[model samples]
Target: MDFYHRAGLILDALDNKKGSVKGLCMAEAKKGRKAGEGARFLKVVVEVLKYRPHIQHLLTATKLLAQEPTLFVPPSSTAAVASALKSGSAASANKALKTPRKHVKAAPSPLSLASVMVHDLLFAKRGLTLPKEHKVRKKLEKYQPALEKENEREKRRRKVATNEGLQIALPEKVASSLEGIGKGKKRAHDADRFAEEGAGSDGAPGEIRWMRVNTLRWTVEAAVEWLEKCGWEMFEDVQEMLAAAQSKPKVFALDAHIEPLLALPAAVSLPTISAYQDGRLLAQDKASCMPAWVLLMPALLDAEERAEAGLLYVDDEDEDEEKKAAGGDAKGKGKAKSKGIRVLDATAAPGNKTTMAAALVATEGINGRVVACERDQGRFKVLKDMLKRADAKNVQPMNVDFLSLKPDDAKLKNVTHLLVDPSCSGSGIPSRLDHLLPSAPEDEQLARIRALSNFQLAIVSHALRFSGAQRVVYSTCSIWEQEDEGVVMRVLAKKEFREAGWRLAPRDEVMPTWERRGRVEACGGDETIADSLVRCLPEDGTNGFFVACFVKDETAAPIAAPALPAAAAAADEGEEDAALEPLEDEDVTEDASAPAVSAQPVKKGGKAAKKAKSTASQAARKAKDEVLGLASAPAAAKESGDAEVKAPAKKGGEGGKKLSKKQMYLLKKEELKRKKEAAQE
Candidate 1:
């Protein structure tokens, strides 16, 4: 009875818009509730919510609530009921609000309790959990035959043979037809349409249990051998695996596209397996694996090549030195600097992609660094635990927001690649039970997607700013076009991106063999850009997902510094003059005279390099105008000539005037300074 009582309270809270089913149950558990109480609440509550619509319809059709109103009336409402009968006035009923509980002759069962009882009566294998003599149970027993009849009618209407089929077979129109069931009140208690609860209930048909071998601790061969020892057989084709897995849960198949990933039946329980317990095998969805794989594919290929040629350890000292400079640990050799590959996982809490990247890096003795960033303190702790479990020693966990990080910061300056899997609307996650909850209003859902799109754009845009980044993979577990192709369109249209040579990596570099590309219309109808993007849905045997890769074009010529149009420039002359004001006069003079060519141009890449080039070019033109008496070149040409200024002195003088006596003296002094500097080197 206490169980039923607590369950009713949770359901009531859900109806009154207090919180989500899981959230409310967890809240209760935190308040000194019994262990496993929350789990029981979730299990019973989720099922009741899913079947409540049909159950309400059944009750109405059978007139069960009307015939047995006493059993359905709650104790709290008895005072009002008695007052209404006595005075036959709404005002008199309100006056009875303080009626004593013992004198009121209250009804034993509430509607919420009756509804849960009805669900168990019709659906549960062993009938109601209540005692046979319980008044609610005895009352429902009288309508058992009628309830059973309506249950069959429901199955007939949906053309399903078993009760389990109702889980996925319920039509949206059926729910819409029952609009009068819980009318008037807002359905604010419904779960987000996109929340994921992993695989459905036991023996769900056609559901695949996707798993990836964590190669950080062991090889794929070793994992397969261990599985064979545990009596699991490997099948070559996934279809064969699924077909045999229906009866034999010990069968598995290698995923064709993703090498280290495997497909098992949803019924297979790997949590108890030793390999899974220790984190050598992970239960990651096939869709979730795509982002890390796509981002690190090129690097993994290079690493494999080096391993095969026996060159992985050939220059240990040089590798360590590079790793130290890049702020990455080499071979778990402490925090010594090494020039190893570096990857940043922008929203890495839960560590799926973070550990995946680490494992991929370890596959061929590729010494690499992975910096996993998570802002939420609670989730950051989870990320640290996951990294430790996965034996991801190369990973450096940061409890800070990735958006707040400066790409030029010393620790992240040499990050060669990034994985931006930021928070999304979760609209694409396939849930086992969340659909049972009522959906958010359409306008509210759209507003949420808009907010999420802005966030996704901001995080990915930030990732592109990394100075040493060559490729950035922006991924989300969202199916919305706005968050997917729409974001890519906006990012590609950014002025900084175009000027920095950031473009979509070719399809060949992405998951080219995965047949589904992005929505063409979503990418503004450009087929090539759409083809470069990746999209996944549950129908593809994975959660709904999207991935887009942005790669820098190293071979592309440097962009000339940007110049405002003459008309626009004149219109904002005041603002431009203000912007040109020097922070410190001496600093400005030194910067203007200093060479614009960076000792390592690649280290100061992206927008930073471009801004420096533009500033230096403007200053050089100013010096030429003031000292040599040459007229300033047009804005476009003057900015364009910045790249040319890096040439030798002969090239600098080719089309310009010869050095004056004062300039000759300065040049001689600079030559002597350079000679001395070289001597010191």
Candidate 2:
């Protein structure tokens, strides 16, 4: 059959299948036609008609081209035909007839013919024209160049999109409508207020897969070798990776900005590597590692300082015994030493930071431990599992709310490092698709941001109160100024923090190589403090992240306590001397005089009278203590007796006022009750 004859048969079959071109093609391919060839023909035809805006227009255009052989043939074929005719040779004409023309099939399916015609009309540089009266002719002419370019682009886009299972094109109207919505000529005046400020008209870059080698499990060399074996090439530089990714068959590269971080092609799926299941590799973002890395600053500096001082610090063999002595009281009441480093993850869950911190501690060979706190039961289980998988032995996971933890809690008394990565809006994560959902109303979003900021401030401020804490890293995966610098400013502005002796560590000191600093002007924070804050944007090859490191200034003077009053000082001095008096002699005299003193009525008076009254009060107190049988009192009994004696002193005069009948009766009733209870025991 001829090309036109076959095209007619395909189109006729499609019409009978209710314009189901894809179904007809699939049925034909199953019956005997080459599946790949039939599918490719169907794809080309579908791409050409995809943006025509009307099914009727697609069918009409397809039918017209399928029915007419001349309209579907290319100009080159026509020229050859003409040249053969002019030669006046039957042999040349016959040869021209026998040769199959470009884009023309000896047995073309209906869909294939339609594809050739559509390509000629919309994409091919030269081809047969449609009838002037055709309904789609004027529209096609109006948007001919755009449609051609779009169809050409779709051919390239399909390869990546198909493998990723992602949609490359929106419906025709939706795509066109989006173009009109945001194409304003005037730039937004407040663009600087947003974290996406410097992103150009193209907006942020696409997301990429970031893999970090778990130094806890596998060395970088081992990880690189394993990945290379799986057909992945590692690039030493990020620019090199970017350059290589522009070509085909996606590649992987080591992240230039962060250690042990590897970047894989955005659209490629990682091969199933055993190392991943074994926890030798983790799929974590470059920015997410910033907190743990920043937290390691002190330990890094300590090592450098030791090296400079020519100190070969060795671990003590008696370290366990020393620590046992150091952790003396169950209440953690003794002064905690600064010799060892301890970290607290205030809101740890899924233990990313916890495991990272633990790994750093283990790798650095530091006398450090990480205390990971998670309140959520479900997430806590996940955290424990992750820690186990990461082989994090230095982490102590606690299922408890950070807010419920007191600054002086025994577990936290020795914690000198803190990490607060609280919950936020997660507005900056592009993959989370926050942008696709209709945004919450502006007021609602602001309210939510404010609430989040308050929570962030509370947790971070609480972390700073730890007595031994010398450094704290506050971080969040939020892009909004309210959740980033706003929280920082509020915490710093509090009056109590003035004496905290801590300030946001200068950015140049923490990750000095990083160029993206916080948006100080937009958030209205102190310029120096804001400059010290760090921000990571989606365009920066990271999930949007904010981190601020606070370090205690050891040189800053400690806050002085208010002085005691002169009278209180004198009183305390007197009590110190009195505490040395013989207890047995005092108790002996009081016990002998107890009955007479209890029967006597006390008189209130001045100095000499006060002296007389004081003597009587002491005798009464000693007698009461003897009656309570507390002379050889246990610690618990002493504490209880002291409390009871102090309670009645609040209502007394200088001479010690005589007990009223009601007070005496109540005291006797309490004594009887105590005696009854003790006897029963």
Q: Pull out the clashing pairs in model 1.
A: 322-338, 322-339, 323-337, 323-338, 323-339, 324-337, 324-338
lDDT of 1 by residue, 533-612 (tens): 99988788887889999999867963332333332232223322222221211101111111111121112468987786
Q: How far off is residue 634 in model 1, in Å?
A: 24
Model 1 segments more than 4 A misplaced: 1-39, 51-205, 246-248, 308-338, 554-681
Which whole-number lDDT from 0 to 100 does residue 617 have in model 2? 56
Candidate 2 lands at a TM-score of 0.50
The alpha-carbon RMSD values of the candidates against the true structure, listed in the order shown, are 19.1, 29.8
Query: Model 1: C-alpha RMSD to truth?
Result: 19.1
lDDT, candidates in the order shown: 0.64, 0.54
For model 2, how does the per-residue alpha-carbon lDDT over 458-554 read when each residue is reduced to its tens digit?
Answer: 5676788687888899887778877677666655544455466767787766777888887756435345666788899877877788998988876
